[model samples]
Target: MDTAVTSTPKPVALITGASRGLGAAIARELAPTHDLLLGARSADSLRPILDELPGATGWPVELTDYRAVAAASASIARLDVLVHNAGIADLGTIAESSVDQWRNTLEANLIAVAELTRVLLPALRAADGHVVLINSGAGLRAHAGWASYAASKFGLRAFGDALRLEEQSLRVTSIHPGRIDTDMQREIRAHEGRDYRAEDFLTASTVAAAVRNAVDTPRDAHPTEIVLRPF
Candidate 1:
């Protein structure tokens, strides 16, 4: 008889828009237990986070470029977690919006996400992975001047719901967070002509922690949706 011990391989997680903000925070939170694939539009953009997390690899590909996304995702034979955090907020009322604005917004936020998830379904299924969508409160409600952005998020939430039903082995989580304090929030405030107050919005770390919690939940219980708001 012989006795031997071998370490299990760490689970793999891929986070889009991981160059900064909530994506990076979630990467940091999962680094200890999982090998990370940090995705951004360009390698240059991913350099900083890749440097911060030496164990992470850069996955540079524009999500809307379906050819590039398919090629890029081919290398992953198995994936434990997939976080859809990349999205555009091209806010405008229906009257003010253009064909191009609506097309671009949906292309980036909804279609691209669907394409990525479709391509990665095999890999995710292999690992019985978890999918996390970083949605906004706009997903739950539409506000004036936010038609396009809100539509994309609402679609995202619907997508998550569909995926949960379709992929019974995989866990799908939609994190619907209120305004978050980040550079994006600042820009949104500037567009609204309002003051940028960090206290008024949720912190990136807090949202990331919520993601970590969903990912860490026991296998017996599925974490389907997590709604977050600032105090």
Candidate 2:
């Protein structure tokens, strides 16, 4: 036998909102096991993750830009994992919420996710990939001041449910994690006019690990929905 070596291809994982906070943590967690494609608003936004995970590539494309997302998806012939972690939280009671706010929330959280997933179906099908939707507790129970955010998350929950039912060859998991200790949480707390306590929220690493667990689970086991809370 000749002295030759065959390199094993690593699984591919693309994570949005991966520049900082929970997305970055997820990127770090999956870096060892997957070939990461970190997505953010701009290539510059992904620089931090690129620095953290040397093997990861920065994929800058606005998730809402259908044309851009489609073009990006076209290049992904085989995707092992697609983690939808990008979203916005605009806190306002239903009465105080504006039409624009609702539209923006839905557009960022639900529509973009749907569109991205739709375009990536072929790549996902080719690899029998996993889709992880980083939902929130708001997705399950709406709070008073989180109308727009909750509605978007609720819509996301429905989207994931439908996708799971439709994509027979792929695995879909809607991770409804409670408030994580991230910049987003800081903003939400500011909206509440309260002091930020890191202990009160779950860690980003914890949530990332949960996502990894879902992805690494045996193919025979389907992790449809997983709820994680701080307590």
Candidate 3:
């Protein structure tokens, strides 16, 4: 009789907005090595991919709700990585954008992520985990129609930076992924201009690979920020 028992993986990652696009790509990239806990608005959209991954679990979550995020955190035993990638972009001049649109964008892009990080910090601290904030070039610079989106991302970047200082023992990375070929980019093109070349956009897979690299790096060495711009 063979009594050998296989050991489970050590590092575990929890990623928000894992249904599709950059989030999905990141989840796929990490699925091979880490146990992934994916959260998105719809379980139906996440199930297909989650089923394919060996060590993964999916939870349908509306990130804007603080209670829901807190509930999700309670279920997680330990976490080695937290990817705050759930965000909504609203493009328009400050005057042109509706009040509701601005509020919704801020709620999803900034406030919710902040709340989730607050709830999950204990677990992350225990594991000495890495926290990856999916930021944008807009966070670093201002653009014409990026009033709301840019403001939200800029706030998030500030939060990530401050949090990094607070948690000196943990790794914090804020990545500004430029022009990814995702639905978000398509929306930008539709509202902004079609003159921008899709070919120049970075693939979600590329951003995903970068995320995995950050997670796999040595604990002592931490890359504070990385800006990936496609040529």
Per-residue lDDT of 189-231 in model 1, one digit per residue for the tens?
A: 9999999889999999999999999999999999988999899
> Candidate 1: minimum summed lDDT over ten consecutive residues — where?
85-94
Model 2: how far residue 143 lies from native, Å:
0.9
Per-residue alpha-carbon lDDT of candidate 2 for residues 77-100, written as tens digits (9 for 90 to 100): 999999999999988888998999
Clashes of 2: 0
Estimated TM-score per prediction?
0.98, 0.98, 0.93
- Which of the predicted structures, 1 or 3, would earn the higher lDDT when compared with the native? 1
Clashing residue pairs found in predicted model 1:
none
lDDT of 1 at 79: 99
The lDDT of each candidate is 0.94, 0.93, 0.87
lDDT per residue (tens digit) for residues 48-67 in model 3: 77777746888788887778
lDDT over C-alpha atoms for residue 2 of model 3: 90
Please tell me which predicted candidate would have the highest lDDT against the true structure. 1
- Clashing residue pairs in candidate 3 are none
